[model samples]
Target: MSTEEPATPQLQSTVSKPPKVFSCVLCAQRKVKCDRKQPCSNCIKAGVSCTPGAPPKPRSRRRRVIETDVAARLQRYEELLRRHGIKLDELDDPVISARPGVASASVDGANSSHISAVVGKDGLPLYAPNNLWSTLSDEILDASSDDERDLAIRVANQSLDSEPSTPPKIELELFDLDTPLPDLSSLHPEPLQIFRLWQTFLDNVHPLTKLIHAPSIQQEISRASGSPQTFTKPMHALMFSIYSCSIASMRDEDCMEILGEDRALAHRRFAGIAKKALTVAGLLTTRDTMVLQAFVLFLLSIRNVYDAQDLWILTGVAVRLTERLGLNHEPLLDSLSVFNAEYGRRIVWQIAILDGHTAGRARIDTSRTLYRGDTKFPLNVNDADLDINMRERPQEHPGVTEMVFCLIRCEFGSQLHNQAAIEGNNMLRLLGNPSTPVAEKETFISKLERIFEEKYVKHCDPAIPLQLLAMVMVKVMFGRLRLAARHPRRFRDRGATMSQEEKDSLFAICLMMIEYDNQGHRLPGMHKFMWHVKANFQLDAFVYILNELRHSSVGDRADQAWREILECFEHHSDVLTDTKNPLHVAIGNLALKSWGARESMLAHLGQTLPDGEVPRPISVLRSQRSVGVSPGSYSSVSDQRVAGEPTQNQAFQVANPTPFDSMDSTPIDWEYWNELINASGIMIDETQYQQPVYDARAMNDWK
Candidate 1:
C-alpha cells in the first residue's frame, strides 16, 4: 500500500512557487485551521485561491533597559507632567492625569511609581507640611520633576518665614529695645510661690481654659523648678502670666488668706512683670506657639488692668498672629504628632473665643476670619490621655473630662456664631434667624440641650467645682438662647404686641436668668471665679426684668422678681453704686422705679409679712445706697406701712437737687436702653470673657 502512496507534491501560489510554505498563509492570516491541501477547507468553502508563506521569525529576547534609553523615556514623561504644570511629587493627585488635553498614555496616575504619599482611608493622599529650602530628596521621583506642589510649598514656607502675624512688638519700660534688657530674676516668684501660683491657676483658671496640658506643664515646672534660669523665655512668660491671672482671680481678702499678699499689690506687681516678660519674649514676631499661648494668657488675665477698648485692640493682634502661624490651616498640622496637633487646636480655639468676647464687649466687630476654617475640633480627652511621643490618636473619653467646660463652650461658639466647623450645622442661626418660627427654634434648642446634657452634663459630679460651673453655665446658655428665640425684637420688628402668656413666659425667663446669675456668683465655692462674674455684668437680664416689673407690680411674679433683683444687687453691690455709664444710669432709674412701684402696691393692699421678720428683698432694698440718690431714698417706706402714700418719689428724690430743674422725672428711655443693652452684649457661656465697658480698674467697680 505504501508503494502506491501519494506522490510528494510541491506547494505553490497561483503565480509562483511559495517560499518553502511553512504553513498555509491564508489560514494562518485568517486564524483558521487548514487541511494542507492545494485548496484549504476555508478557501475551498469560500471559493478563492489559497496562498502559502513561510512562518514569521522567532521573537528575540525583549530589549533590556539601558540607562540612556530609560532616561530619555522618563524625561519624556516628566516633560509631559511639566507641560501640564503637574509635578512628580504632587502626582499623588490623579486629577492631574485627567486635566484637559493631557494625552491619555499608558501611564496610570494611581498606580504610578512616582507617588509615595500615605494613602488616606478614602484613597486620597495625605499632605504633609513642606520645608522651603530643603536639599534634593533621596527619592528619585522627587528629583525627577518640578511642579506646582513645589512652588506652593515654597510660598507657604516664605509666608511663615516672613514677619507674619507679628503683633506690634510689646513695649514696656523695663524692656526698651534701645537699652539692655533689665534683670527679670526678681520677677520670678519664690520657689514655694511657684507651686502656690501654679496650684492657684489650676483651681481658678485651668479648668475653664484647658489651654495648657496639665500633666506636661506640671512636669516642665518640676524639671525647671530649682533652676528657673533653665526655663525658656516663652515658658517664663507663661509663668508670669499665670501669676498675674491667679492674683486677678482672687479678692484682696482671699489673696491675703491664701498668698498673704494684698490682691491689688500682688496683681500690679505680677502684671507689670508679665508685660515685661512678654516684651522680652518677642511676642510680636515670634513663630513659636508657646509665645502665642503666653500672649493669650496675658491678654485675658489683664482684662481689668487695661481699658476694654485697649484689650479689644490687643486681641485683634493675637488673632492675626494665629492666622500667620498657620494654626487655622489644618493641612499644615497633618505632619505634626497627635499631641502637638491637639494642643494647636486648643490654642487656636481659645484665641477665637477671646476674640469674640472682646469684640462683643468693645461693640466693635473686628475680623472673624477664623469662622471659615476647616480645622478639626479638639478631641474631648483629659490631659493624661495625651503625651509628647504619642503616635496614634487617643480615643476621646466618653464621660466628663476636665475639658468638659471648655469643649462645650468652644462647641457652642463654633457652631452658633464662629462657624469654625467644616460641616457644622448652624443651630445658632436658627435661634436668631428672623424667618424661623419660635416653636421650631425651641425644638432645635431642646435637641441641642439634650446633646449637652447627655454627653457632658449628666456625667458631671456637682461636688466638683468645674462640673458645678459647667452645670450652671449650660443652663444659662440654653436659657439665653431660648430667650433670644422669643425675644421682644422678634415680635417688635413686626409691630406685634407680645401676648399676656408670652409676656409671662418672657418675664419668668428673664427673672430666672437673673436668679441663675445671682446663684452662680453667690454659691459658697464660687469665690474663685467671682472676678470673672463681676466683670461680666449681665445687664440685659436686669433691663428686661425691670421692664417686666414696670407693667406687672404686685403679684407673686413681682415678689419673685423683687427677690432676684435685690440678691443680684447684693451680690454685686458695686454695680448698684457706680453710675458713670449712661447704661448704668438707666439701670439705676429702672431699679428704683420698680422698687417704688412695689412699695406703693404693697402699701395700698395693706399687705403684711406672715412672719414678723421683714422680707429679705425689702430689707435689702432699704439698706443699700445708690449713686445720685441718697441713702435716705427709701427712708419714707415705714416697716409698718399699712396705709397712706408709701415712699413717694423716695427712690428718685435726687440727694442734691439742682435748682434749675423743674419737678424732674428722669423717665428711662426704653429705646436708648435697648441699644445700650445690645452693646454690652452677653455671650453664650464662653470659657473666656472680656472686660466690661465700664472702667473696672480705677474705680474698683468689681464687687
Candidate 2:
C-alpha cells in the first residue's frame, strides 16, 4: 500500500449542499430578509416581485430629519396666523405680494440721494404711504369698501339659494366637499364685488358658517341691519325668509364645529331664522300666508315646537288663504292635513297597540293562527290565497264600518237576518227613531248584512265594510256570536248577485267609512277589527268579500287589506322562541304538503249550503255544481219499487239479475258494500276482500 503507485492523491472531503437562504429582488434591494417564494413576503410587502437566490443590492441611506431655522421660524408664524383666523396658506410665496404691514415707495424716489437724505431718527429713509397719491388713494379706499359690501351680499344670496339645492348638490358632489368653507375673496377677486361674493358664499355655505365667519358676516349683517335699509318690500322679506330657511337646515355637525357643541348656540342661530320665517308668514296677506307653511311646519316640527294647535291654525288659515289667492287648491293646507292625519293615525294605532285594557279579548294571535292553519280553505268566497297581499282590506286597516262588521260577524254568529233586524232596530233608535226615510234604515241594515255576509258569502271580500260590520256585530252581541244564530239555514241559502251599480254604491259607502275613521283618527273597536281580520280570516271568501267591498267607490279598503296581507306572509314567527305557537313547523308542514294551494272547498260549502242542510254532505257538494238532470231514465214502476221496501240489499242491487244471485236464489248484500265504497270514495280491491263476509258499514265507516 505504501508503494508510491502513482503517488496517492491527497484525499479531501467536500460536501455539496443546498443554498442556506433565498431572497426576493425587492427585499435584497431594500437589504431585508426575503422569505423567498414565487412572490416573497418582503416583495409582497413592498408590492414588487421576488427572484430566489438573487444577489442582494446595497440600500441607499435614508434622508435625515434635520430642521432649518427658516422652516422653524415659518411654522411658528403659521401657528400664530392660524389663531387670528388668518391662514398662512393665504399668504403669497417668494414675498411677491406686499405683506400686511409692509410699505412700498415710488420707484424713481427710491433711488434719489436727495430723497434718501430725508432720514428717520434711526437712519432709515423716510417714505410716504402708498396712498400718498391723493386721488388714487381715495379711489382705492372707495373700491375696498364697495368690494367688502359686494362679498357680503353675495354670501347672503348663496345662503338663500342653498336650502332647496343643498341636499341634491351635496349628494351629487357638484361642489367641493373637501373645501366646504371657500375663501370668498379668492372665489371673487374683484375688491368691489367682495360684498356680493361674500353674500354668495354665505348663501352657499351652511348656516353654521356664520359661527366660523361670524366676525365678518356679523359685522356686515349688523351694519346692514342698522342702516336705513328696510326689507319692507314683500320680495325682500320673502327672499330673506328663504335664506333663513336654508340656514336653518344646515348640518348640525357643521354647526357644532363653528358654534360650540352646546345646542343653545345653534338654537340661537336657528331662532333668528325661525323668527324671520314666522314674521314672513304673519306679514303675508291671507293668500300668501301659507306659501311656505309646509316648510314652516316642517321646521317647527323638527324644533319640537310644532303641535296639533299649530296644525289647526295653519289649516284654518288655509281655508280662506287659497280662496283669496285665487288658487284652486290649498296644496299647503292639503299637505299639512295629510301629514298631520298620517302622523295622527300612526299615533292612534300605536296607542291602541300599547293599550293593555280593552273590553274584548286580544284576538290578534288567535286570528293569525286560525288564518294560517284553518283559514287556508276557500270560503264559498273567491280567490283567497295564503299570500295575504291578495286580500282586499289589510288586516290592520279595516275601516270603521268594516271593523264594526268584523265584530258583528263574530258576535252575531253570521246570522244575517237576525243580526240585520237587531242592527236595524238599534240604528233606527240611534237615529232618534226619526222617519229619516225607509231607504236609510234599509241601507244601514244592508250595510250590516253585507259585512256579515262577506265572511261566509261566495266571491265576497272581507273588506272594511265586512270588518266594520263584524266589529259592530261583536259589540252588539257581546263577545260571542250566538252559535244557534248561525243555525243551518244561513249557510244553505244561495242568493242572487247584486247589480254592478249597486256594488259600486256599496263600495262608495265603504270609502266614506274609511274617511270618517281617518278623520276622527279614533274609532273605538273599529281598528281591532282590522287587526283581527288581518290576523284571522284566510278563507277565499274573506278575500272575495273584500274585493266585493271594493266595488263601491267610497270603499278605501285597499290599504288596510294590503297591510294585513303583507303581515300574514311576511311576518315570520321565531320557531325556537314561539313554543305556544308552533306556527313555523305547522306552516312548513302545510306548505310542504299543499304547496301553498288552499283546500278551500269547505269555505264554498259555508257559503253555499243552507243552514239546515249543512249536515247533508251531498247538499254541500252539490250546491257548487250546476243543476241539471242525470243521464239515466227511470220508469214509474221502477221508482215505486225503489220507494217501497228498498232495504240496503235492494238499494245497492243492479237493475238486471246477475248469475251469482241466481245461483244462490237469495239476493247477495254485496251490492250494498259496493255502493258504500263508492259513496265513501274508497277503492277496495275485489281480490283482497272477496271473502263475501266483509261488513259493509265497518269497511266504509269513513262516510
Candidate 3:
C-alpha cells in the first residue's frame, strides 16, 4: 500500500498559474485586480457597471522613426545661424527683444551672470537691445527664395484682409449757416390742443419710448407755457416732436385732426419744425440728451411715413451723436447724479437696440459702429423711485410694466443680433473653406438650437407684455427660418423626411406667431408702431406656411395648413386698409391673393360651393362663415378639412358679407397674379386653374 504511494504524488505545480485573470473588462483594460463576481469589487468601487469578458489582446507597440532629413536640416540651420553670430534662442525669445530698443537680458542677477558667462560678454549679455535685425533674421533666412518671400507676403496680406478693420469716423456739420430756425409759432398747436396731445402722447407713445423723464418734461412744459418766455430752439423742437407723435398715435380720426388740418399733414408739419430746429440749433454738436430724445421721437412719428433709407441714415446719425456724447460708455458711479447716469444708460441702450433692429431690417451690418461693451443695462425701476440725488434699487420681485418689457425686448434683440453676426461669420468661413467637416456644421446648428431653447423658448410667460411676447416669438421663428434659409435644399429634404411630431412643431410655431399678432392688437394701449415691429414676423410666418404647402408630401395636412393661413389673413383684413403701414398692407394684399388663388383652384377642381356657384368671391364666403364666430375665436384648420366633407369653399355663399365684397367687380391682372405666385417659388400647373376674377373695387381702393 505504501509502494502504491498514493499514485506517486503528482508533483504539485509550484507556479500558481497566473490567478485566472478573471477581472471585468474595464478593470482589465485599466490593469487593476478585480474580484471574480457578478459585479467585481473594482467595478463597484469605481461606481461602474461590471462587464465581464475574456482578457483583451495586448496592443502592439508602434515603432517611432526619427526624420533624419528634418533633423539634419535643423542642425545645419542652427550651425549657420551660430556662424553668423546669431543665436537661435536669441531670435526665438520674443519677450527679450519684442521691440527695437527694449530687451530683457535676464530676470535676476544670477541669470544675468550666467548669460554673460555663456556669451563671453560683460553687462551686454547675449544680445543688444538696438539690433532690430536680430528678430527678423529667422524670417529672412526662411524666406531666402523669392517665391517663398512672395508667399509669405501674400499670406500676411490675406490675414490682414480677414481681420476686421476699424470704421472711419463720420463728421457732419450740424448747423446750417444760411438757414435759420423755422418760425414754429404758426405750426405750434394752441395751448389747450398741446395739453390734449401731450396727454395722448403719455397714454400711447411715452410707454414705448420712455426716453424722456415724465416729471422733467411735465415741469418744462408747464413753465414754458405759463408766460411769454422765450424757449430754446431744442426745447421747442422737443415739444413739437412729442406733440406730433401723440397726435399720430391717436386712433380716433377726429382726435388726430389738428386745427382742421389733415392728421398726417399736421404731424408732418410739426416734424418739419422739429427738424429745422435741430439743424439751426446745431443739436448734433450740442450732443444734448433732450434734443436726441426729441429727434428719436420725431423718427418714431415718421417711421411709416419716411423712406426706409432716410430713416436708416437718420438713425445712424443719432447713434453717432450718442456715441460722441460718451453715452455709449457707462458713467462712473461717483461722477454724476444717479438720475442723470441712469437716464443716460437707458438712452444709450435704447439707441443701440434701435440701431441693431434697423440694421437687421435694412440687411446692413452696423455692429461695427454700434458700441456694445460693458455699458450697464438700466435698472428696472419705475420713474417715481428715481430722483436727482436718490439711487433706488430695482425691486427683487418687480411686476411687469411697459418699461420692463421694453428692456427685456432690447436685451433679447441685442443677444439675437450678436448671435446672427457670429453665425454669419461662421457661415462665411465655411463658404471660404468648403472642406470643413459636416460634424462641425451639425455642432453649430445644435448650439443655435440650444440658444433658442434657453433664451426665447424658456421665457415664454403669458403674463409678460404682449409686445414682449410677440418679440420673443418673432426672434425664435426668425432664427429658425434663417437657419433653414441657409440650407434650403437640406431643409426641404429634411421636411420631406420629418416625422409627424416635427411637422407639428413647425406648424405650431407658425400658427403661434400669427395668433400672437392677432392677440397683441387686442390689448389696451397697443400702439400702431407695434404693427411695424410685427410686420416681418407675420410675413415670415406666412412664408413658412406657404413653403410647407409647396413642399409637404401630405396633401391633407397641407390643405389644412393653407386653410388656417387663409383664415388668419381673413380675420385680420382690416390691416389692408392701413395706408400708414405699407409693409402691413403689402402683406395683407399677398394674403388676399393667396386666398383668392386657392379658392379659384378648388372651384376649378369641381368642388361644390355652399351656394352651388362655381365662381363666387372669397370675401362673401368668409363673411358668411364669420357671421357668428367671435373675431378672436381660434378654430383649428385641420378640423375644417374633414375627409368626407366638401372643400372649404362649400362653407360659404354668394351673400355679400364683407366690406371687401363691394369692391369685387374690379378684375385683377392675371399676368401680375401669376408673377407673384411664381416669385413666391410655389410650383403650380397654372393651366389647370382659371385666373381668379379680381374685385375692381378692391384694386381701385388698393391703388
TM-score of each: 0.63, 0.17, 0.53
By the lDDT metric, which is better: model 1 or model 3?
1
Off by over 4 Å in 1: 1-176, 366-371, 417-436, 489-496, 535-537, 609-670, 675-703
What is the per-residue lDDT of model 3 for residues 1-703, given as tens digits with 9 covering 90 to 100? 8867765555344353345546777776677777778898888888989987685689955322234224424644554565365644567578534544323233232332122122311132222111001111122212224453333233223323233211122123234544434566555667777777888777667766678888777877777664313667778778878876876676547554545667766766676666776675577677677788877787777664554334556788877877787776554432657777777777766666555444433323343434454456566666676666676544622444446455554554344334435467533243212234434644554555566455444555555454455455444434343333232122212234434433444444554555555555555544444533433335445554543432231234344455456555554553433222223323433333344444443444456433343222245433422322221121222212222222333212111111110011222222222222222222221111111111122222111
Ranking by TM-score: 1, 3, 2
Stretches of candidate 2 exceeding 4 Å from the true structure: 1-244, 258-265, 276-305, 329-703
Tens-place lDDT digits, model 1, residues 257-286: 766878878887888788778778887878
Candidate 1's displacement at residue 268, Å, is 2.8
What is the per-residue lDDT of model 2 for residues 1-703, given as tens digits with 9 covering 90 to 100? Answer: 6686445453222234445666654565567766667777666666754666645568955322132223323533543454354534345664634344322222231222111112222233323211011001111101124443232223223323223211111011111232122221122113322343235334432121111212333354445443313323332333333333333443345345443344444444444443343444443352332233323332322222222222223333333333343322223223333323222222222112111111011111111111010011001111111122232322332223212322222223123323434455533132222224424544554465455445434332334444333333332221112111111111111112323333223323332322332422234434322322222222222222233211110111332322232233332222112212212222222221111111122132232212322222222212322212221210111111100121233211212111110011211122222222221212221111101111122222111
Better of 2 and 3 by lDDT: 3
CA lDDT for candidate 2: 0.27
Window of ten residues with lowest summed lDDT in model 1: 129-138
Question: What's each prediction's clash count?
Answer: 0, 100, 6
Candidate 3 wrongly placed segments (more than 4 Å): 1-175, 226-230, 252-260, 331-334, 391-402, 414-504, 523-537, 547-597, 600-703
